[model samples]
Target: SFRFFQLDPDWISCLIDGAFSVGRVTAADAAADQKLHQKHVAGKQPPVVSGFLLRSYAVKGWPKLQVDGYKQTAQDEADMDGYKLKILRLAHLSPNVLLCLFEGDAVAVDIHQKPEMLHLGFEIPDTKTPDNYSKNLRKADGTDKDNYKNPWAIESIQPDPATRVVKVSQLFLDIEKKAALNFTAPFTSAQFALSMVEGVQKVRFVRSGS
Candidate 1:
């Protein structure tokens, strides 16, 4: 099996100059995926949905010239100070998807001839565990300081296969000094209808109340 990776111009130059070599490394946590191992044993291949690039640079001390493992030396600890960029595979889309909802007998929603507001969607974390994002950081020194946190967002929403019950865990909304409002019943029970609106796909969740 072969995989393709998009590289930067500097990396391309290094490859041409015979100064580039590749090494294989897997995350310590992800390597323990029992499901992935079971599939491998059964001669089944997993689909690759995306690829990530971790680019790291020095912040203070020079990079240590040694092998990386579960163990770390003093220089390895000190050299961990650096910045990293997560390069994600992205594609261009025009007339992006949006969500809208309406209820009751008749509700008039108008789209004018003026420019529409552009929306940027962020991918929410699927799991509450910080193990997934450990490699994304420049310093994977195994410390709480390097752990990822999403204070004002939904950590995960798991739907039970045996029942209609859906569980939402670690959801936070920071209103900052404003009175907190709760919509626990309707928000969880609200059903969304997804359809094409003006040639753009949308997921509309009609509100039960204001």
Candidate 2:
């Protein structure tokens, strides 16, 4: 079966830069399903549609970590330090396409404007388990301080005979403009990263099946 995972833009940037090494999972990870399960069992609350739970959704032999020679531009490196981004992982489902969801901010009394956002995608090494998976995670190397607390990789496998390799085909920024208003302003990834660092809200990842 196919599934979707939501990620922070900072983590996504790290994925693009090849320096990220942690992914966080929490009770909120399965909040939607848990609420639904509760509703079905007791009919007490409304059904909430959220991402799949990490505990149940993760594939076996997953949460793998590997080093890929991914690098970011000098501008990106200079701007990344200000944002408080979280690392997260989703396993089990091998996504064939990736989508980014950017929520517009309320600008005026009747106007909503798109915030600065950047879209990027890249291929990493195939998922594999390291010989010192647990040991490497435990060692604090001053670079990845939260390594012990987060899972660094996702494992993807073909669920059927037809599917061969899972890859991302699309990467672009999504912005909403008021139909009645004609506003055209182009923003770059660096600006988006700065906005995120400045506490701009409503940016997330949306994955789909191929």
Candidate 3:
């Protein structure tokens, strides 16, 4: 029998990074199948989707919520801040994939156009636990606000199998919003799909309203 005791830092890093990417962290893990398969995360540890670029999806269990556009009728206008991007709850939760949903009213939705819009998306955090975010804030002195810049945004999250800690790396975004997302929230869910409008619906819901 041969025993190996050495660990390759580069290989381990790459392997974890790949797991996070393919895993799609930040998304919900509450689905029956996904939870059984991928929900083994300990504590607040959500599985990381991607690690290389600091972007990953965290999975959780949430109701079949509706991202009500309030009848945008138009597209571009719904992706802006002034736009009404609201999440309406449908019913009980189900085994579904919850991606980061963006909020847009009407004006912003109208302003955004296609082709370029496809290059935008949003980054939503799977969980909004204050401890998960605030615990990381503050310094030893507990008085240096300037030195600290760890603000909270709706980004994906991950859990370390080894350490069992969930963390947010980067906000989800299309290639275009990648740079801007670092400082702000990603685009709304509808905006993200329209930007990539393929099989996605113009206005959508995570799960069918039951």
Candidate 4:
């Protein structure tokens, strides 16, 4: 779990509109969080910042999270897992997802919970090819392990962009955090699928658990 963040200080992956990054956490926590992108804030009023995901009106990147009332909450912190997020870019959508990035005033950490690995007993057509969140556990047969071939379904995808090589790493993190557990939320999984691939123009999610 080597969760990397704004290592350059000037770099921030935007959390969603109501989310903030959790800092000063442990490497183990960071590692676990990186491994699962799950985190909870432990303060009555924690400092909220932007995540690296941003859609600044000036460049190629993920959309930013909008914080309406930055300093009005008694318990200002949030369980990033507690809120729903969405990426408003229609152009970035595809039939097969590539990956997602966060780039604003955000700090993510790990939430402690024992999640069972869900087993969706079916195979996707192109499990070997990487979508936004696929882990390349390719075997000698050029196929992936069962888990890699089939991961937990994601609840929702927050659209962000990045040309960074590390983008895939971040995408994998997202899968562990969101998809592995609660895969059901208010989102069109079909639209998401269409958002990932090109030309085929349709998606109907098959049931699979992480």
Candidate 5:
């Protein structure tokens, strides 16, 4: 629901190139779990931007929708559930892109006849100590619910004219395949955009009845 207009292209370039440095958790977030806070302070791990997830929901009174040329197929299947895509605020940056700490399967479904919605789920390893401390420090809805074990779900809004929505799974796979071939070369934005387009084109829409 919040927007960051005209983000610096160089910064965006840095993000796509994975050139940014990791940051520490916020004081407010660290306050939620003391053990997690201690871990954060002890430099066990630093917060890093991971991946982004996108999904759509239906609301009453909104006009019929089309996303990336996919028309609204089921009017009665809008996502009315309380679950919302979690939005995170970067240190000094405005709310821009959704970030995840890990990678996992992306789930897509048509619910209540709304647009086909996508859910990006990150797979954080289960161990005595978790690598994704930020994920373990927040609730499912991206709120500070004092519960740290909730899974991450990111919903996408309509893409801005310049923004592109890509299938997370496909992009991940493409990146992996490319990395295997060019292990030493740095991944470029152009390559990422190419992967994104490939992924978006592969999404199949199915109409689920209300």
Candidate 6:
């Protein structure tokens, strides 16, 4: 019926102070196209971009999403289940904008028949240690809630880095270009070897002409 989104606690004050408002990235469908699509709506609905999970690279914070407990339930029971999403950096001219980037499988939102009609739920993790739990247990229990011996403190999703993978292919390509410009190794050999080949060819041509 509802979905949970995790956000950093440090941004709480800034957000409450009206520093910036959250924006949703929706499908850019033309008014005419939207009307036409609505007319032909049937059993299966088309996929749409509900919104994006925003992360700011400017914040020196970790991003993480962890499940506390394991429950055996039918997949159909959930209206919308949790899934992994790829991090993408948006190119912006403004220096104030965050440049968060990630390389991995992108997540697509499910096409709901009447998504707006469904109830929406938003939750922010409460990291404060409850009366029953010790203050020292706050950080550790937040992550491993199910295993923790505490019964009062609700599990808080701590920040963690989402983009764990490095683009090795692109990294190698950049390194190759840099090495050639800096005259590092094999490129040095190839550059000089071509001169010798050209010299031998010129000598053979002169002999043949003679």
The better candidate by lDDT, 1 or 4, is 4
lDDT of 6 by residue, 1-210 (tens): 112122443354345334222332344434444454446642232222122233334222321211111111224525223433344333332332223222322223221122233221113224672222211112211132332454432222222236434343443343345322333345333432221121101000011111
Question: Can you write out model 3's per-residue Cα lDDT over 106-127, one digit (the tens) per residue?
Answer: 1111111233333322233337
Compared to the true structure, candidate 4 yields what TM-score?
A: 0.15
Candidate 1 Cα errors over 4 Å, as ranges: 1-149, 164-210
What lDDT does candidate 4 reach at residue 72?
Answer: 19
lDDT of 5 by residue, 1-210 (tens): 221122344565456334222343576543544454345543442233222222222222222222221222323435312222222321212233222222211122221223343333333434763332121221212232222332221112222235444355544444445332233445555443332221111332332331
| Cα-based TM-score, every candidate | 0.14, 0.15, 0.16, 0.15, 0.15, 0.16
| Per-residue lDDT of candidate 2, residues 1-210 (tens digit) | 323333454454445334212242565645654564446543432222123222322233323311111111123634433432222222334322222121211111111112442222222333572211121111111131242354331112222235533221211132111111122344444422322222112222223321
Off by over 4 Å in 5: 1-64, 67-177, 180-187, 197-210
lDDT of model 2 at position 209: 22
Task: Give all candidates' CA lDDT scores.
Answer: 0.24, 0.27, 0.31, 0.30, 0.30, 0.28
Candidate 1 matches the true fold with a TM-score of 0.14
Residue 138 accuracy (lDDT) in model 2: 14
Candidate 2 segments whose C-alpha is farther than 4 A from its true place: 5-43, 53-58, 63-141, 144-205, 208-210
> Per-residue alpha-carbon lDDT of model 1 for 32-140, expressed as tens digits?
4434444553233222112212222321121221111111112353442221112222221222311221111111112222123222122333477422211111111
Scanning candidate 3 in windows of ten residues, the lowest lDDT window is 50-59
Q: Positional deviation of 156 in candidate 5, in angstroms?
A: 18
For candidate 4, what is the lDDT? 0.30
